[model samples]
Target: MISTAIHCGACGARMEPGANYCSNCATGRDDPNTRALFVVDGTTGLFNDAFTGALVDHETSRAMRYKRPISVLVAMLDHSEFIANDHGPAQSADLLRELAEVLAGAVRDIDTVGYLGDRFCMVLPETDQAGAMVAADKVMHAVAAHQYAAGHGQWERITLSLGLATVNPDRMGRQDLIQSATLALMDGRSDGSNKVHLVSQMS
Candidate 1:
């Protein structure tokens, strides 16, 4: 009989054994085989230069090593499209960072946000599809009302393409998890902008 004793990362309290997750703080059971949820694959020098480097270190060293199932939120800023059409890059970049920071504040400290290629990856630990949706909404809302202060001589607004997906180690591996979420993002973006589409996978 494998007794899985769940424990909260925030506070050392014995969680209800075999619980879906830690009810108190949503800490998931420690399993060495669950897939990762977050996938941010973006180009360099968009959000921050250190984003991708930091992401790789964290994923390989901490996330993958622990075997915790991951949930991912990807935010892609189409600056090139805007620039080609004679739009402001500075204003757009600022808005993107603001949205990313908002998402960072919304998740638990244990969770991580990293750069994957040109996109930003939000690693949600033990969070399900529903919870990820709520978190994504928080970011969307935060970005929506964020004014770029027109009087400050700024273009003052930017659009984003976002997607959400969860990684279940019991079902997927590293490459597959990334592929699943990436496909979802593409599908969502194909539909329209400013959308948060949930991946068709178990959260």
Candidate 2:
């Protein structure tokens, strides 16, 4: 689907990926709302936490209004601490940016993906538990397929331990759903890496 994430200031045209100016009118985007709509990595550009949270809030409301399912996925790199300690924070942070890019490419433009605290989170609107699992699996596969610089010019593979939670809007709020997925991810990581764990509404 075409993403209506941001629009041109001059002509109200939709901004395309990797665009700094409007393709139709070449208008410069200085609008705060435009920045909020574009998701970027922390080190690279503007990463808006409030925007992600607000998107979740809107999605939750939409799900409730439509009686649909919404799923949240929380994922972290396996041995992340070790990577930071061994290779330094810069490398680890770079990997995270790469992870975010991979995740951005893996899902639809409508989906929200960004750093929620230290871990990465994806909010999938109208996605049920099954769809969330599939997305999580795709992420794991994407991580496996991409190689990262391990420092000293050596490249290595990394894995993700992901947690997925799905619920109808009537069951939980945005934060609650994210927390459920995060807790599930913690549990799954304890068992093994490169795995996707699923959870439903709390209690």
What does candidate 1's lDDT look like per residue over 149-193, in tens digits? Answer: 521343355455677777554554453334455678788787777
- Each model's TM-score, in the order given? 0.56, 0.75
| Range of the 10 consecutive residues with the lowest summed lDDT in candidate 1 | 35-44
How would you encode candidate 2's per-residue C-alpha lDDT over 106-149 as one tens digit per residue? 87755767676578888888887778788888888988887665
Task: Find the candidate with the highest lDDT and give its number.
Answer: 2
Clash number for every model? 16, 0
Q: What is the Cα-based TM-score of model 1?
A: 0.56
Candidate 2 residue runs with Cα over 4 Å from true position = 1-41, 44-46, 150-155, 169-175, 200-203
TM-score of 2: 0.75
Residue pairs with backbone overlap in model 2: none
For this target, which candidate reaches the highest TM-score against the unseen true structure?
Answer: 2
